[model samples]
Target: MKKGWKLAFLGLLAINVVVVLVLLIGLLSPIKEEPLPKASPEKEAVEFHVQSNKEDLNRVIKAFIEKEKAKSFVDYNVYLRDQVELYGDIAVFSERIDYKLTFEPEALKNGNVVLRQKGIKVGKINLPVSYVLKTARDAYHFPDWVKIMPSDELIYISLDKMKLESDLRVRADRIDLKKDDIRFTFQLPIEQ
Candidate 1:
């Protein structure tokens, strides 16, 4: 090829290489206004109950409802139809609470509640349930001898399990809890 023609061909080749390099660089750069939407965190509600009398259990539950209602939050009633065992040292109560809750603006897609009874009688203590949620919410309170882990808050809600004298005769649409240490499975939705 002649000198002038060779020079023109080389110029064309250089322009093609520059165009390809520019295209590659633009593809690698993060484009503006194309950020992904953030994912919403999930909330779970489980009811863990301990052994107690029905009347006594209802009283505290009622108070808890009123308290939540007072805060402008909707209250849900739960169904109780399970056998429980109460001993001199300990007691256990379990129930399933399922309700369509609407907390407004930020609605909770769904919640699972595990209400566990603290096995404490109210002869005259009359302590608020919210207060109890913090200090000694269960039988698994921190021992006085050693400091409990920072996350291990003192609560009387440590319901391990209780052996039963007879078979349980209740049917939970979600789960069944016999008077023994049985690990519960699945979310319970007891239609109240």
Candidate 2:
């Protein structure tokens, strides 16, 4: 209302406009997105195999499972699969393992098997989280052993000079509606 007050208010408004205009210009300026480094085709295909196993490791896994079962009735039907030598000094092995309840008869038939793979780097193998299970009848659960359960597996015998162990896994190609049927690159040792 007063001349002095009006001038002061107008000056404040001018300052606000300048500030808002500067901010608008800054916001409208081009913003660059960081570019992601491109991966080479070969490097992109980098993969590792399961740990190679010799007679020693083979006997150990089998005997260990057997021993555990006899001592405590913790039944684990393990079938090794996907034995590979993806890289030098690296060995990966995988298997389909079913761990039943201490005394559940359906123990073997109540759980699911995932086709797990690993990328072996030095003495350790990095297991990936991709295993296949028979389709779930309804929920995200599988009936462990419906139709033919995966039994029997493969073992990659490593060279005598290499000190390695065998890991086993079941590889799946697709997931079923019930998550029951699974397709794999290889066949089960059971072959049925």
Candidate 3:
């Protein structure tokens, strides 16, 4: 019985030694962890549709003109009726002559508005369209986005070049005077 007890004690001691060795090895081993993901610098853009009517557009355009007038004095006033009309006075031989210029507005696919010269009434006098356009281009203080081409007898409004607050961009999706349907797209940037 003593010999059997000694053998049992030896067996228990060996098992205990193996368990301690395993625990020590586990404690000394290096632990590995996954690194955190980095943030991306790319930005995304969101698009929004805006709809307006002729009356509201007229008011907004008038307000914009008024704001622009503060920067520089402009004698002309633009309004949208059946057609885009420009009412202003021009200097002819040192005399101020009132003129009404009408233009047919055409919306381009690239977010631009072109005004084709439709008619001009200069105080009961007949003047060439190109001549009148050249005079207006030279006299009026137009915004940078407005380009007047005398030879082409047209005025181009670059809506894509317009700068708005908060890095927003606008595009003319549709502009129909007869149907009174005007639509625009506003592009906004989203940061990740």
Candidate 4:
């Protein structure tokens, strides 16, 4: 080969080698994952009680239905009738939902209930409610910190996850549901 062509080839090869090495170094570098701040021992624990009535809950559901209607994913007609029953620390809720999918005939799904740490239970079938709730997160492009949990009769939103300023772990300790009102006792970790 000619001298000029040989020099050009060697120069390109050296550039390729340098690029590969830089990429390799970047891939091999240790990834530093920031640890969650530790909770302070002296911090005081906080408990919050939230209560809502059936009418208010229905209003929220209506608003959600309207929002979904605006999306127009599929032609749908949905009606949800929720009934709550209390069983000490556990609350059992039953819902009679009427839905029509696309152009098909209307169908009814009844006796849906919420299970602790579990998703919605539809009749004898169990559904991954998180998968359904994830659609909302994807639609609005929400962050991972925003958590949603849906049950057959109720939906739980983790408030602590929304708080970016503090690493506060929170969960529902007790749930009480009645014909008139639904109540929740949330337990929060002590912040540092």
- The better-scoring model by TM-score among 1 and 3 is 3
**Number of the top lDDT candidate:** 3
lDDT of 3 by residue, 1-192 (tens): 999999999999999999899866644543332232222232367989999888999999988888876765446788888888989775655688889999989877776788999999999988777777876766677887787786688888877667789977777888887788889888787777
Per-residue lDDT of model 2, residues 19-42, tens digit only: 899866643544333222222121
Instruction: Give all TM-scores, in the order shown.
Output: 0.20, 0.21, 0.72, 0.29
Model 2 ranges with Cα > 4 A deviation? 33-36, 40-192
Candidate 2 lands at a TM-score of 0.21
Model 3 per-residue lDDT at 59: 96
lDDT of each: 0.32, 0.30, 0.77, 0.39
Note the clash tally of each candidate.
Answer: 33, 26, 0, 0
Residue 138 C-alpha lDDT in model 4:
35
* Comparison by lDDT, 2 against 4, better one: 4
Order the candidate numbers by lDDT, best to worst. 3, 4, 1, 2
Put down candidate 1 lDDT per residue, 1-192, tens digits, no spaces: 699999999999999999889866643543222222222232242344334444554465466545544543223342333432221121222432222111101111121122344333333345333333322222233222212121221212111121113321111122233332222222222333
Clashing pairs for predicted structure model 4, backbone only = none
